[model samples]
Target: MSPTQNIVLITGANQGIGYAVAEQLLKHENYFILLGSRNAENGIKAAAKLDPSGKSVEPITIDVTDDASIQQAADQIASKYGHIDVLINNAGNNNEFTHYWKQQESKEEIKLDLAALRQIYREAYDVNLFGAAITTEAFIPLLKKANAKPARIVFVSSHTGSIGLRTDPSSEFYERMSRPSFPAYRSSKTAMNMLTLHYAAMFKEQGWKVNASCPNLTKSAFTRFSDLGRSPAESAVNIVRLANLPENGETGQYLDENGIVAW
Candidate 1:
């Protein structure tokens, strides 16, 4: 790897917005991406497709839910590159419970299966919130070794998680507060926002750029592969933009395609 090349690690990069982010970042010759995925075969296949000559991207197996896997991946990166310029925590979970409290069903006073609801909450929190926190913890040493002045850390979050917008009557997502939907998934991301803030504050003195990015209804597996939403490529625009923040770029801000998402 070139000494000047910036190393970027993007988790859950085998498909969806994460894959698109890798694709977009590859446009810049200065970037060297670690395409992180839980499945080694998937990661290898993705890296091969993204960097056929095996020059820019490396596939690494990293299961955010597994502490050992996270630690192993971090150790590997620390050994290979000594530092990481960017860490994009894109791996997440949104399960059956997320869609259980359907808008139509709520009118019938329908109820979610209590056991399943709790199960999904556990799953969502495990991957979305705890996973990110632990991954960041494992990677702090590598990030501190960064060649760049200020390392960039981005959390792939949802604007629907914003309490500020959820409370505003005029806001597009205000209705979400009335209708019970995605409680497990949304709350996990809401907690992730706080996690982002705390990390930002902790690293503020070192000028680390720790922020959240909302893809905003992107067409990906996360959205059940919706056709109406924007493509993963379009959704990745702001995330890659955040991942590539400059030395003096803004920090602790929640950003989306339009910029400056409400807390």
Candidate 2:
């Protein structure tokens, strides 16, 4: 790897949006991409598939929900590159989709099973909220060592987490398909948005950029690869754009493909 090349690490990159982002970055000669997957075997396969030449991409085992796994990945990166120019917290879970569906089917008449709801919330938050937080904290030191002008941290979030859109009666999200569902996933992303703001504020003085983005219903395994949403490659455009932002680019904001999204 060239000493001047930028190092980027992306979690949950074996497939979906993460995979798409890696593919897009591979076109840039100055980028050394770290494809992070929860399973070591899967990561290796993804790296090989993404880079048959074995020159630009390297697989890294990083299970966002596990601290030990995150630490190990961070240690390995620090040992090799000493710093990371970009960290994409893209791994997320919507485990409570079924429970939320059940709740919506109740038509506001029946109370949800408390135990089941708790389990769903816990699992969703574990990956979407706590996991992202842990991963970001673990990589802060390496990010500070970036050779680039200003290191960046991007969080892959959703519009369902947008309080403005959720509350605005005139908004499509509030008008159509407004049935209560995915509470855990939605709330977790909301928390993540707030977390992004805090991190941006914390690092502003240090010239580190931290921001969150909504991919706008991408068709991937997360959506069972549904045709209703945009393709993963299409959705990755904004994410890759953010990752490649200039040193003076905006931070601490929520954005989508069109432009800046409301908090």
Writing each residue's lDDT as its tens digit, candidate 2 over 1-263 gives 77877899999999999999999988844788999999999999999999987778899999999999999999999998899999999998976765444566787755558896788788889999999999999999999888887899999998888888877777766754255767789899999999999899999998878889899887887876768889899888888888888878989989988888767
lDDT of 1 by residue, 161-226 (tens): 888888788877678654666777888999999999999999999999999998888778776676
lDDT of each: 0.89, 0.88
TM-score of each: 0.93, 0.93
Model 2 scores worst on lDDT over the 10 consecutive residues at: 95-104
Name the 10 consecutive residues with the lowest summed lDDT in model 1. Answer: 96-105
- Model 1, TM vs. native: 0.93
